[model samples]
Target: MVFRRLLGSMGVGGPQVDTVLAGGAVVPGGTLSGQVCLLGGESAERIEHIGLELLARVEAEHDDGESEGAVVFERFTVGGGFVLGPHEERAVPFSVPVPWETPVTELYGQPLGIVLGVRTELAVAGARDKGDLDPLVVRPLPVQEAVLEALGQLGCGFRSADLEYGHIGGTGQTLPFYQEIELTPAPQYAHAVSEFELTFIASPAGCQVVVEADRRGGLFSSGHDELSRVSLGHADAHTLDWNAEVDGWLRRLTDRPAHQPSLGHQAAPYACAPPVHHDPYGHGAHGHQDPYGHQGHHVDHGHHVGHGHHGHHDPYDRHDGHGSHGSYDSYDPYDKDDDHRSGPGVGTAIAAGAAGLAVGFVGGMVADEIVDEIGDFFDGDDD
Candidate 1:
C-alpha cells in the first residue's frame, strides 16, 4: 500500500510527494525497496532534498499512566539537491536496510498489532513538508519462525500481541520496548499454568527465547511468575525437539524455589533443549494443548497454578484457570503432565493447526493497512 499527502508546509501550488512500498512484509535487517514520486507545482522549483523517515507507534508507560505516540526510529536522505521543472514528474527509488532491532509485526502471516510506517518528507526551496505516511509490515526471521511454529505445534494458540515499554533486565536488549507473543497453555499443562507469554530477541550470534508462565494458585498459596531464557543457533533449531525443549523450559521455570524472588529479573540456562522425536514426514506434531482463557486487560501474569516456597511461604497445587476443566476432544497427541506439561498429542496439534490458518489472513490485513496509509500520506502532489 502507498500514501500520498500534500505538503502542509507549502500552500497551494507547491510540489507533492507519494511513496509506495514493495509487496509483502520484510524481515528485520532486510532491505526495503520503494519509489518516491514527485509532481512539480505551478512552476518549476528547485527541490532541495527528499527524505524518508521510519516511524513506529510505540506505547509509553510512566509513573502516572500510559500513553501512545508516533516515534521516528530511523531516517534516510534519499534524493536531495535536485531541481524540479514546472509540471514535471520524477521517481526516486531507494533500498534501505532495516535495523536489526526492528520489532516484528507479524507471525505465520498474522497481524501482531505492532504498527510501523515510512514517512516521506520533501524540502522545497526553504520550506519543508511532511508528504506521506504508510504502514510497514515486518516478518520474523527464519529462526524466530521455527520457534513459534514449534510452539503452535505444541498446542499454543495466538493470543493478543503487544509491545511493552520497559527493558528486560539482564539481557542484550537494544530497544526501549519489546514485543510479547502471548499464548494459551496446552491442556495437560493447563492445570499448572493459566497461560504463557513468549518473547524473542534475535541477533547475529543467536536468538534468545524468553518464556513466562502464569501458574495457577491453590488455597493458602499465592501464585508467582516463572521466567526462563534459552538461546538457539540457526543450525540447532531443526535438530531440537521444540516441544520437549519448551516443556523443559516450563518445568525449570516452575520448579524454581519461591524463596528466591527476582522481580523483573530473567533466570539463566541460555541453551536450547534437545529434540523430542524425529518425524520422517515434514509435518511434525509439537504444540500446547489447553484452550484459551477469557480475554483480560493484560496477559494476566498473576494466575496461580501450583504452590512453591518463595522464601518460607508455601504455594498449593492448582488447575488451569481457563474456565471449566471439561475435557475437549483431544486435539494433539501429547499426554498430560502434573504441572500441565504434556507430551506431543492432540492439544499441541490443534494449536499449531489454528495458528497456521489465522496468521496469513491477519498478516495481510495489517500489511495492507500499513502500506496504504503510508502511501496515502507520502505519495502525492505537493502543490
Candidate 2:
C-alpha cells in the first residue's frame, strides 16, 4: 500500500481525464458543453479542482522576429472536491460560455486553417496535469458570414486567415488578439489594390468591420496601405443587400486618393461622413497616432509583405530598414502560393465566377494533409 501511495505521488497511478465536446461546430458567444471523464488508477486520489481553458494559436511580432504560441483567452472551473476510488470512473459535465470575440476557425463547413482548442487541466493532491486537448470548431456569426459571402460574390478570393497577437486601437476590442482574414482583390479592383485584409469585431449590440487594402503603386509611385471601416447591426445581415453594400465599401476604399486620409482619422477626407473605426497601428492610416503607444505598429503591414518570401529563407532574416516582418517557417497548412493557389481552390472557384462559396471542397489529399498537420501540431504541444 505504501508503494502504491508513492507511485501515486509520482503520478504513476493517478486519475486520468479525457474531455469530449458535446456537439458539432459552435459559434462565438455560444455555449461549449463537454464531458470530462475521469478514471481512477491503482489507488484512490484526492480530486482538488478541474479547469477548462480556451486556447488559440496566435502569432506575435517582436524585435527578434515573429513567433507562434498558445494564448489562453478564457478559463473555467467546473467541478472537483472529491476522492476517486481505485479503478472507479466518474464524468464531470460542464457548459461554459465562450467569449464574444473568439476567432472563427471555419466558414460554411470548410476549415480556415485557424487552430483553436479546449484544454482540460486536472488538479489532484497539489499536482496539476493537462490531461486532454480537443480541437475547437467555431463557425462565423451570421453577420460575418454575410460579409464574407458578399465578398465571394464580388469575385474576391479567400487567401488566408490568422490570429494576430495585439489589440486594435479605437474599438471595443475585448480579446488581446484579433482575427485577420486575407482576401484577394477582384478583377475590377485588382489593378488598384493587391489584396484586402478583413477584420470583424463582434459584440452583442452589433459588429464592426474593418477593411485594409494593399494599394498598388503606379509607374512612379510606391505602394502603401489604405484602411476603411463600417458598423452594422445583427439584423442588417438579412436586411441589407450585402453585395451592393460591400461593393460600395470596396469602391470607396480603392478609389480614394493616395494622399487623402481614411475615415476615423483626424482631418480625414471623409470627416463629415459617419466615422468608421480603424486600427491606428495599421500602416498608412496617416495622421492617426497609436493610442496604445505600441512600439511596433509599423511592423503589422510589413508582415503581409513578408508573405511573398515564404517557403524561402526567414522573412524576418534582414531588417532592411523596414520593420521586422517575421518568418512563417513552420508548418502553415494555409500557406499562400505565389500564383495565388489556395487550399481546396474554393476561393479560386469563387473568383472564377462561381455562383457563390461552395461546400466540401476541402477533401482528398488536401483535407488529409491539413488534418494530419493540425493533429501533429496539437499532439506535439501535448509534450
Candidate 3:
C-alpha cells in the first residue's frame, strides 16, 4: 500500500512523500520494483536521498521469553540527489535485488501468515523521515517448489512457517534470521517420526536444504531429532530426482542416531531438533520476539535433539525455533493459482495502492498503529 505523508518532522508545509511498490509476488533472489512519489511543499527543497528497506516480522527465543519486532534485513538507496521545485511533483522509480534467502510468505495461493514489508526513507535538507511501509509477499523459488511438491506427494502436510532470530551456527546464513517451514509427518514415517522442519538457505550457487526430523524413540529410549543436509542447485529444479532424493534423506534420518546430551554441543551438523517449539516461549505466532532474546542476547544452544560424545550437549548451534499448522484437506498439486494470481508484479503493485493501507492492515501489528497515528497526527483527525 502507498503511504503518503508530509515529513512530519519537517513541520507545516513540508514535502509530501508516498511510496508505492510495483505489484507482483516476488521470488527469493528476484527483483522488487516500486516508485517513490515526492511532491514539493511550500517551497523548493533540496532532496538528499530516497531509500527502501526490506523488513520482516520474526520470532526470537531466549532466557526470559519471546516478543515481536520489525527486523530490517535489507536496505537500498534507490534514488537521490535531486532538487524539488516548489509545488512540483516527481516519481523516482527503482528495482532492487531481494536476498537469495528471503522467506516465503505464501504457498498454495494461501497466506502462511508470514509478515514482510518495504518501508521508505526520504532525506531532505539534512533531515530524514521514514515515509511509509508496504506489505511484501514472497513466493518460493522453482527449486523450492519442486522440493515442497515432492514432500506433498509424499503425504507430508503443510503446517505453519516463521522467521527465527539468530544464526544457524555452521551454515553460510547471511541474514540475522532464517525461515523455517514446518511440516507434519506422512503416515509411512509417522511411526518413526513425529514431524519435521525444512529450512532452505538459498544462494547463487544452490540451496542448502536442511531436513530436521523429530524422531519417535523406541520403547527403550525417548524421542530425539535427526538432521540431514543436501545440496540442491537451481538447475536441479528440472533435472534432479526430488522424490527419490527426499526419500533418501528420510531413510537416513530414521536409520541414524539423532539425539545428543542437553549440554554444550553446538556446532557443525546442527541440532536436528526444533528449538523444539513453534510458540515454545508463549510468544504470539506472528512477529513473536523474546524481548530478552534480542540482537545482543546470548542464545542458549541446547535443546532435546541430536547426539554427541558429551551426551549432554545439543548439536547444530544457534537456536532455531519454528511453529506449524496441522494438516488440511483439498490440495491441488497442479493448481492454477499461479496463472490466476496477478501477473509477475501486478498483484503486489495493486497492494501498493493507497486504499488497502489503513490501521490494522499489514501484519496486523503495532506498526500499523504507529503509521496510522502518524497520519492522523498530521491530518489533525484524532477521532
TM-score per model over all chains: 0.68, 0.70, 0.69
lDDT of each candidate versus the true structure = 0.58, 0.62, 0.61
* Residue 383 alpha-carbon offset, candidate 2, angstroms: 12
Residue-by-residue lDDT tens digits, candidate 1, 153-248: 766667766666445544565444567777777675676678888887754445677787776665645455666667665444445566676666
Q: Candidate 1 vs candidate 3: which has greater TM-score?
A: 3
Model 3 C-alpha lDDT per residue in residues 162-197, reported as the tens digit of each score: 777665645666566788877778787787888888
lDDT of 2 by residue, 232-332 (tens): 76556556687898888898877866543334322211111111132212111112222112222111211111121112221112222211112111112
Question: Over all chains combined, what TM-score does candidate 1 have?
Answer: 0.68
- lDDT order, best first, reads 2, 3, 1
Model 2 Cα shift for residue 227 (angstroms): 1.1
The weakest ten consecutive residues by lDDT in model 2 span: 267-276
| Order by TM-score, highest first | 2, 3, 1
